[model samples]
Target: MNSPLSPIDFEDKRLKIKFKLEKRLQKELQALTKDPPTGVKVDAESIYRNLSEWIVDIDGAPESLYEGEKFKLMFKFGSRYPFDSPQVMFIGENIPLHPHVYSNGHICLSILTDDWSPALSVQSVCLSVVSMLSSCKEKKRPPDNSFYVKTCSKNPKKTRWWYHGK
Candidate 1:
């Protein structure tokens, strides 16, 4: 006969997983700080205390519709990060008015959702966002922007976004 695992045992297992995740996050953060991607700047203050949340400042690409504009992106990581996509959204008063960007700051980028891969890093994501903005021809919100803003959750990760071709 075999004995079942105790509650204490389960707690211990959970702690171990949490510790490993935190260590991985720390390493990633360190690497990111040493060499961040172009136009992206991570908020070091938040990373000093917590690895689960990060604030990044992005500069709009030159000659683009958003040229000379500055935007702030908030990234929330789950324990399953690297394997799981981070929850990213534009935060602050000056959200971009791009068609793929909602009025409430939710972005409709495919890689941030269905196309995400463990191989993608924070740098790649930032670059991709910049590329998306640079390729835009119009400065406007999505067609359903009004309806989506009114009904969407505060957390962009919770929403099921329908991505159109680029």
Candidate 2:
């Protein structure tokens, strides 16, 4: 069991998940800070609750529909963080909907949902979301966005997604 005062050991499932996330986060920070993706910038990041949640600030892709946007996204690490999947979403105002995004900022991606696996890391999720934004050429949300927002079933991990097509 984890003591109140001592840091949880890596062997502990939750603590282990947290440690791996932190390590991945550090590596991503180093890579992005040195060579960030086009139109995406990292503003801030943090890990808390024995690594149960990670908060990251990102400047949206420039000149795109999401350009000039600042978003705060939260990644909720479950007990089965890697084995299962981390829940992620935008947690601030101005979370717009796109073909791949629900109004709630929950994303639609295989890696973060059905296709997720232990081999993937936090970096992949971030890149995928960013790529998702960059892929948007319409500069607008989907046509049936409102309906999808209301009726879409969340991923098995309880993530909401705006599926663009059947």
* Top candidate by lDDT: 1
User: What's the count of clashing pairs in each model shown?
Assistant: 0, 0
Highest TM-score scorer: 1
Q: After TM-score superposition, what is the CA distance of residue 14 in candidate 1 from its true location, in Å?
A: 1.6
Q: Give the alpha carbon lDDT tens digit for every residue of 1-166 in model 2.
A: 8556434443576676667767765665567657765544554443423345666666677666677777776777665656777887767886755666667566667777777888776667776777677678765565666876687555335644434443
- Per-residue accuracy of model 1 over 35-55 as CA lDDT, tens digit each: 987788887777778778888
Q: Score every model by TM-score.
A: 0.90, 0.64
Error of 2 at 123 (Å): 1.7
Q: Worst lDDT window (10 residues) for model 2?
A: 42-51
lDDT of 1 at 114: 89
Q: Candidate 2: where is the Cα deviation over 4 Å?
A: 1-50, 151-156, 159-166
Q: RMSD in angstroms, candidate 1?
A: 1.8
Q: Give the TM-score of candidate 2.
A: 0.64
Model 2 pairs whose backbones collide: none
Worst 10 residues of 1 by lDDT: 42-51
